[model samples]
Target chain A: MSDNISSSRLTDIDGWGRSESLRSIARRSFQFFYDNYFRVEWEGLEKIPDDGGALLVSNHAGAIPMDAPIIMHGVEQHLGRPVYGLADHFFRQIPVVGTMWSRLGGVPAHPDNAYRLLRDEHQLALVFPEGTKGTSKVFTQRYRLRRFGRGGFVEIAMKAGVPVIPIAVVGSEETMPILFKINSLAKATGLPYFPITANWLMFGPILGTAISLPAKFKLRVLDPVHFNVPPDQDRYSKSRIMDESESIRLTIQENLYDMLAHRGNPWLG
Target chain B: MGRRVLLTGLGTFWGGKVAQSLEKHPDVDVIVGMDVTEPIVELERTEYVRADETYSILSRIVDATQVDTIVHTFLVVDSTQMKTKRLHEINVIGTMNLLAAAGCAGTPVRRVVVKSSGMVYGCTGRDPLWFLEETPRTDPPETTIEDSLVSAEGYLRDFAQDNPHVSVTLLRFSNVLGNDISTPFTETLSRGIAPSIFGFDPQLQFIDEDDVVSAIEFATSANVPGIYNVAGDGLIPWSEVAKICGASNLPLPPFGTEAAASILRKMGLVKFPPEILQLLRFGRGIDNSRFKDLGFSYKYSSLGAVERFAKTKRLSKAIGIPRSPYTYDKDVESFFHHSPSVVRSTQSDSTSDTF
Candidate 1:
């Protein structure tokens, strides 16, 4: 296996490069995308620290994964710190897409991978602790945070002892409204679940192209909540670790759910 | 003959220190320490009376003891019991009782020194202005139960005017700090902790314990019947104070008054006797030019008292010097060291999970 493909190894991105002109270019590019393509609105940016290693956990929305990118761009523009996403395995399989993902500092989604990255490197790790269940949830279960399975992110954080920052992204699901889910097709394809959205059936067959509606995205970063894990728990059993992790995961998820409910509409003034 | 002086609220941290100082005074004939607690000190004239500082109990104590000269040092720092009824009971009614008893018994009470906080200025909303003795008390909206302090000053002023024989001296003190046996600011400072500061720019003045006692003594001897600002010489910013004390200066975001309330709630440090919070947040500096004219001198006149007292007590172990408390967390330290590498791996892992 190539050194680049090593499980524990990480390829550094030039996101935090100090080339002033390049930085300005990146800023202008982000601004252009924000102004023309999608109008981005952010709230509670002050809660995210200017410089710190934080764990950003958000409820996954939009089957196409628009929430994560919007959050990353929002945080990056506001705090001037490059946000790195913890991506799943399929993205790395695609040729051109995989290389772009590597450059963007996309790590593997395994628990061991998260633990290694968080412990070895101090960069911000953005995760959807709700997993596929949240992203694949039907439109009927709108805005409700799914059961975050025994939060591995929380356990990794507890072991790493970093602050967990709960974030909420609005308007992503509205961009591509999911109509229903085909369980048999999802099972046959070995995917988490297939989302049958308004665009999914009409865009490909009738229009011969996929087009997502332009929705105003609002991203909010909540105050960093630090976990005080006991030092003696280093030698504790896996069950204890899992229990502790799940507690933190649920707390962050609940807070995100509440914040989304309170925020009302991201697009409205 | 040493003059007989009645010191109320002698059980409190500040009151106890004053009681100790009065006991050491060569000319103080008797230091009748009146407190709700059992008497611990056994000095010849240092007696502790087990009575509450209420209208009835104080009247009885004054009558029984024939206490003519009263040093009104009694104060409650507990915010919970700073209600109107409670404040009136202790501050207004209690002072009335002592004055009435002094009048009935014909004890020839010449001077009554009342210790008040400079917090009566209501330091919020107003532009930065030096407060003089004549600054009118402005009522602040929504304060802790101890906020009745602004009204108490009016009572003191009125009483001083009414009583021809008895002279009332009001010493408006800044934040009082020193070797307080009970509520020691030094102890908290030594432990590398600070009472959560609500705002970014916290301008504060502090009077030392010794200075407070000296001021009271000055008031007693001198024929002054007006308000005086009894604070230290210099002012210090809250950020600098945190640095000197070796604690983290956490800036509370400007959430307006709600944020301030939240901080006080979270920290659980908002304990001041009834009517003190209004004066605390609103009231400004009490002009001490009058007291200075009467030849009063202070030993420690800066909020740097924490550093000075800490050095004296050899409390280096409590406050971590050279090394900060942030280094205590290994994960935090590791994160700082390898932040870039960690971000990359986490991102890749997340991407791989999607496929």
Candidate 2:
């Protein structure tokens, strides 16, 4: 097939040729304990294509949104192409962080923007189906995924005919074990919920750290499952594709749960 | 024949439950109900003393009834009415008066159980561990109701120390949930709007009224001296509690000095006072494992106490008392209709100015 877009356009859209300063900062931050402290293990890096349109679906945990940066760093290193992220609207309202996020190709998860990013831009979109509810779930309810909320991610992938890649990140839960949920406080702050982790309040100003213990994070990017729809068939026929998509979701969830159960050392081997 | 136990405040919310539980004790010959109001006719008490918990008036009833065990459960907990003077009068001085009366009573006064709050562990600059019976009051910020509690506890501790003959058992309880009195926290929640929670995460512990009464009786019988942490069996996050109570839809603004000022300004019959708001924003969990180790089991533990409390007629009446027709969007209209614009503006100004 003939190349639809020029390499320059692809590079620009992917945020591959962005500011060297930002890239350097990100690289240094991840490399702070790259060899000494945290030894990250990636299981399925081959599943992600070097350059193309795809969807990366992952299980979310961690109080400070730690999983996102790790996934971004890993993808940039392995695929040699920048991955675009779909973030919540609130993040865009921040001052300096918002501008940096935009520069790094973090698009708001508005449906129109997401569709445009996949179809016209041909950039890989990362979406968490369970949303905030999944990440903020109490320790008692961890790993037990909430309802996928009618599978909108599956529909988005099928409509664009992009392959769906299920990614799982273990050790995020162990980093900050949610002791209990502070309902009154969470409701007061307008957040979905805030986990009452051990020493969260007392150690905040003293340490300037939101989470404790740098648990070894194990990322497993499952093999992509492609949805083949005939050219003449309408988008309405996408419901047939959900059964397969759900199987992938469930399979990844089970594998992640099992891995978390058996995995002894937080410092990944 | 054994003498009747004159349990004052039994007719009131917390005391009434305590009186009812004490009735099950075989050693007790009778339970004499006394409060500001008349006792429930259905309650099978030996006698009902319709007297105020004030020292002079209650002293006569104690003399007449020949009450051996005087369980003083009378204390007003209205945060709105707790001015500095009122806090000293009711919580500190009022408790002092009762203790003094019990000490000098004609009848053999064996024990005095005073219900204190865990709010004394004010929000700032303290270690998070089990608050033992002997934990000294650290210098808390002046803006908390916990300050009042600290003063109250100090007075009680001194009184207990002086009158060693009177077995003073102080139960330092967390939020007490039951049907009788409407708590400011749950009442705000029942407004059906998203209640503003403070900075996202603060540990919460609640004690059921059943447990409260059980704890009082345990204190009365065992004559356990010193402070004891009395709370429900399990802990739940406030967010989950709100959701379970169907009050999670309401938005909670960030609680700071400004929020406290606004709450103080909105100090109506329904609103919480500044002191209470301060307590809500920074309160910690209470450890009641000591009570459990003493072979005590709570009847309605956890948020189940809230559910039980909601089932009462008092709650139904309060909830049915028709709020204004204005939606949360029309907060200005709601405030203007409910309170003076000057006060509302001042509240808004204070909140903005402070934080």
Candidate 3:
């Protein structure tokens, strides 16, 4: 209870390596993109429970994947609840972006990290099971979902005893459409995939990789996928897990087509 | 009869500190401490005996003394203290020999408490936020020290399975920060600049040095079996740790960090070993709840330990540590411990609680 107990701490970083002060600073920048640039719209946001933990599974695209920030910012703004965006551990391999990402609630997409966040801490966790494969799609293959990584995310939700909430986002594909990818370059660099985005062609070397186009975003939250089976099992049925995983994928794919069909313009709602 | 204890690594920080505290315990009847060198700390009742670093004649000593408890506190966790071969000899071979001596056909040792480091859970990108007692390492051991500890723990696991009658307590202590003990971290913080992986601020867990002694004592005295993680509560970022120590973060290039750290080490500017280097990139944390469930408590949290270390460093800066406050004299110590003519008094230490 002494003043020196926690007074010596220079930053407000938590055990998860997330810092509220830093998150707020990052939020200010993200708020601009969420409001003006993307103009993201959401439907059935209340389906994301007011309390308890739930896993958010969404479609992933864009050279930079702007859907993560758009969804996280919208949830945080409306519900005032922090949403932990789980991505590939590759993000942690980078230097400054790694630390900045962690401070801004970007957790490495480890199943253990996800379970701890959802079951133990009871916080909303967002995951794009498509991983890099989803983001690797070119402009021609836009809106087409990829295989959710062996249904590992479903297994984690089953183990953590949380509902899997499928989220369908339209317009993320156009944010920074991948014109094509250079596999040899990706192999040379040790990255999963190297994409040449349309943004890069327009904005040149620097701003190309950083900027996302003005794409009107529409996100729909589907009904929660509850396994209803008990939690914390050592192993769940693999067949059942894949079935649930593929079902969720189909639902999101269906929702994307519906949302896109309703929108008259790609840049206007 | 009261408990007879044999403590290894008497000259080391943990061995000496624990021996000092154990000497005051009413239940402890015999204290036989063995090490490669003379104990730096003065002791009232601990009988010192010189042994090889690998403790070659450990079985003979255990058989002759018939000590009921063996406290293995000498395993080296610090990589910079010595060469790799020496580290392997002390950590793996020394532990294997000690366990062999304690668990031989008809040994008197009933309880064995081994002081392990949290480094056994190697830090990696795939590691969980909080590792439970049963959580397996995300990656295999990358450094010699980590490999040696993992191997020693493997032997310990086998020992526990073979000897059900004997209690085995493995206390995996987090990176320690306190007065006196010199680890790679302590050395870094004592210097003016604490080099960090550029753009990487890993969350690190710490245990106070005094709490390290207490945790070992708790495991030694209690019948708590199985492995337990002993760390101060919570984790703090490396940046915050440097700030607490009043040291600036000298960012080492994250891309070529190992090369940069080696260059710094060559210049004698820092001592960031491969293990510490990986730790700087990705920190490790272990859940300490299982140990707390055993009714043990830590006096300081991670923040408290850092704050205390900073204060102690400041004081030591103002006035350097007293040079050789106590030196071991073999003749006098032998006489006081063995000479029947010298009148002895009951060691009802009034200040035992302070330690």
A95 Cα displacement, candidate 2 (Å):
16
> Every model's Cα RMSD, please?
26.0, 23.2, 2.0
lDDT of 1: 0.59
Instruction: Residues B181-251, candidate 1: write the lDDT tens digits.
Output: 33434444545555432433333566766788878777876678877888876555444555655655433
Candidate 3: docking tier? medium
Residue B314 displacement in candidate 1 (angstroms)? 5.5
Q: Give the interface RMSD of candidate 2.
A: 21.4
Residue-by-residue lDDT tens digits, candidate 3, B95-147: 99999889998999899999999999888888887788788997889899999
What DockQ do you compute for every candidate structure? 0.01, 0.02, 0.67
Retained native contacts per candidate, as fractions? 0.00, 0.00, 0.76
- For model 3 the local lDDT of residue B50 reads 98
| Window of ten residues with lowest summed lDDT in model 2 chain B | B346-355
Per-residue lDDT for A1-269 in model 1, tens only? Answer: 12221111011223211123443455577677676666777667788777656778887877676777677767777777766677665554343454345344555465544554455456677888777877777777777777766666766777666777877677776666677888999989866777777676667634422555566776666667776765214444568656755665566466656656776554441
Candidate 1 docking classification: incorrect
